[model samples]
Each structure stands twice: as C-alpha cells, then as structure tokens.
Target: MLRGFYGAGAGMITQQRHSEMLNNNLANAQTPGYKGDNASIRSFPEMLMQAENVGAAPGGRNELIGSMNTGTYMQERTPNFAQGDTRQTENNTDMAIVQGDVPVNEEGNSGALFFNVANEDGDLRYTRNGSFAVDGEGFLTTAQGNYVLDDAGDEIFVNNEEFTVDAGGNVFDDDGEELATIDISFAAAPEDLVKEGDGLLAVPEDEDALPTAIGDDDINYDINQGFVEESNVDLMRTMSDMMESMRIFEANQTVLQAYDQSMERAVNDVGRLQ
Candidate 1:
C-alpha cells in the first residue's frame, strides 16, 4: 500500500515538470532563434519481490514472487536545434544564419551554427539571435549590449549602421571598404551547449570555445542581412502536449487519492479489530 502511494506521487511530479517545460516553449514561441526543449522520462529500476517470513522452497531458498516497478521521473531535457523560418526585417543590422548540410558527430547528430559574442566579462558565448545594433562607440552589439565578435576573436567595429554583410560574412562599409568578417561558430553536438538566459548559449567551463564554421568545405551556410530567424517552437504541438501532460497528472492524482482512502480503511476498520 505504501509503495502504491510512492509510485503515484512520483508520476505526478514527473508530469508536473514536463508540463512546465511545455509551458516555457509556448512562452518563447515568438522569440527569435529560440529552440524548444524536449523532455526525456525514464522509469526506475524494477525490484525483485520475494516472500518474507515464509518457509524455504525445495532447495532452502526463499519463494520468488514477481518484479515490481518503483516509479518514473524526468531524466533530462534536450533542446531541438532545427532551424526556424527567417523573416525579412529590412533592417541592415538584422542577420539570419541559413544552415545547410554540415558534418555529423559520432553520436549521429548533425552539427549546428551560431554567431559568436562576448559577454560582460569578455567571455565568449554563442547565440543564433541576429537582431544586432551598432553601439555609440562604433562597435556592433547584441540587444543585451554584448560585443559581436569577428573571425579573429575580436569585437567587430562597423562604425555605423550603414554596413553590408556578404554571404561570406564579410562586413563592408557604405564606401565598400572591408572592416571585418563576422564569426560563425560550429558545434558538433549543440546539445552540449548550455542555454544561458537572454538568448545566449555558453560553452561548458571545462570546454573550450567552439571552432569557426568558416573554411570547412563540407559545411555549407549563408548569412542573410536584413533578416532574423524565428523561433522553431510549434505552438499547436506544445499546447497539445501540455494538455496531455495535465491529464496524466490528474490521473496520478486520482490514484494517490485511492491509496489514501485504502490506508484510511486499513487504519480505522482493519486495525480496530473489534
């Protein structure tokens, strides 16, 4: 009876976490370059049940019953790196990365591309958000004021908003003078990148910054100016998944209530033994 309570309670907690993830996806549906997360649920190891305080079997071994499951929980959450549709904003600073065929990692997962930026402490970070702006100091920066990095791992100084970025990520001023080339980083396993808030992805502390995606003949990609990539979240699917998760939560709640009632009967009627 106690095991039943534990199982039902675990199920409810798992579904609650799943629902929260789906809700987060819905909230970021309109965010540019946002990737939705998928939940992975796994069951605990099954335990072998044996008769207790009973006589030994033919060979002096306890009688074996059946296997019983403990419960389930959410194991991990992985982000989906599928590219989203690009929308033309007609703004020169806006850029969009259109990824093509790329080398797959040993895990059989395709690699991904991202724009390199420097955080407040000048630490390297990655992001797909292309809504850039030229700061007062003639340096290109993200919405959060992070410096946009060039191919040489230096900050890109465009001097003005009237600059053009070519397919090769070369930044050319209005007078046609090449200033710098935008840096595009490649992640063989993008899921390993940690998602920091404010549209930035950070490399693990123990890992080095990702390598540039340029000069790789096998890697094909294009940077489009005056455009931004939309979030890849599917609102309809997220809503449906949220509903299903809620239903499972309620089901578990009902099961837990049943267990509570059974326990009450055992304590009041069975234990009374009038």
Candidate 2:
C-alpha cells in the first residue's frame, strides 16, 4: 500500500522534470546554435517478493510471490549535437561553420566543432554560436562579450566590424590583408562537454582541453560569413513531447490522489473501533 504511494510520487516527479526539459527546448527553439536535450529515464531495480512466515512447501522452501518494481526516475539529460540549419544574417561579423568530414570516435559517434572563446575570467570556453561582434577595442567578441580566440589561443583583433572572414576562417581587413585565423576546436565526443549558460560549453575538469580542428588533414570544414547557425530544436516535436509529458504528469497525479484516498480510508474507516 505504501509502495503504491511512493511509486506514484516518483512518477509525478519524473514527469515534472521531463516537462521542464521539453519546455526549455521549446523556449530555445529560436536561439542561435542551441542544441536540444533528451531525457534518460530509468526504473529502479526490482525486488524479489516472498511470502512472510510461510512454512516449507513441497521442496522445503518458502513460498515465492513475485518481483516488485520500486519506482522510476529521470536519470540524465543528454544534449543532441546534430548540426543546425544556417541562415544568412547579412552581417559581416556573423559566421557559420559548415562541417564536412570529421573523425568518429570509438563509440561510433561523429565529432563536433566549436569556436574557441575566453570568458571574463580568462578561462577557455567553447560555443557553436557564430554571431560575433567587434567591440570598441578592435577585438572580436561573441554576443555575450566573450573574446573570440584565434588559432594561437589569443584574442583576435579584427580592427573593426568591416573585417571579412573567408571560408578558410582567415580574417581579412578591408584591404584583403589577412589578420588572423579563427580557432575551431574539435571534440571526438561532444556529448561529454557540459553546458554552461549563454551558449557556452566547458570540458569536464578531469578532461583535457579540446584540440584545434584547423590543420587537421582528415577534418574538413568551411566558414560562411554573413550567416549564423540556427538552433536544432524542432518546434512541432517539442510541442508534442510537452503535451505527452503533461498527460503523463496528470495520470501520475491521479494515481497519487487515489493512493491518498485509500490511505485516508485505511487510517480513518479501517482503523475505526466498533
């Protein structure tokens, strides 16, 4: 009887979390370079049930009932690293990476690419967002003001917004003189990267920094100026998922209510003395 209540409560909590994830994806549907997350739900281990205080049956063993499931929970959320569609922003500072051949890891997952940036703390970070801006100090920066790094891991000084970036990721001034090359980092398993807010990704503390994708003979990619990669979230699918999650939540709530009513009866009516 108590297990019923616990199972229903766990189900509600799991659905609530799943709904939150779906809502977040829907909200970020238009965010540039955003990746959607998938929830991994798992059930608790089953417990073997047996008759209590039962004498030895035919084979001198206690009577066996069955296995009872404990409950379920949302285990983890994994980000989908699929490429988003590119839209032309018609801004010189905007850039979009068109990834081509990339090396696959032993897990059979293709690698991903990201632009290297440095936050205010001078810590290295990464992002797929290419909507860059030239600050007052002639340094290239992301929308959130992170300094965009070049191939040498130094802040790129593009001089002004008029700088043009070629398909090779080389920045050139109005006179076509190359200034610097944008640093693109490669992750053999991007799912391991932790999501920091504002479109930033960080490598785990135990892992080393990602390697540069540039000069890699096997990797092929091209940068397109005047464009940005849109978020990979699917609007209709997210809406459908949100609805399903809500329905599940409602069902769990109903089950919990039923369990509560049964408990009330057991405490009041069943325990009542003649």
Q: Top model by lDDT, which number? A: 1
Q: Which pairs clash (backbone N, Cα, C closer than 3 Å) in model 2?
A: none
**1-274: candidate 1 lDDT, tens digit per residue:** 9999999999999999999999889988988899999999999999999976566555555768999999999999999999999999999999999999999999998999999999999999999999999899999999899999999999999877599999889999989999999999999999999999878999888898898988989899999999999999998889999999999999999999999998898889966797
Q: TM-scores of all models?
A: 0.94, 0.95
Tens-digit lDDT string for candidate 2 (189-231): 9999999899999999988999999999989999999999999
Poorest lDDT segment (10 consecutive residues) of candidate 2: 52-61
Per-model C-alpha RMSD: 2.0, 1.9
For each candidate in the order shown, give its overall lDDT on alpha carbons. Answer: 0.93, 0.91
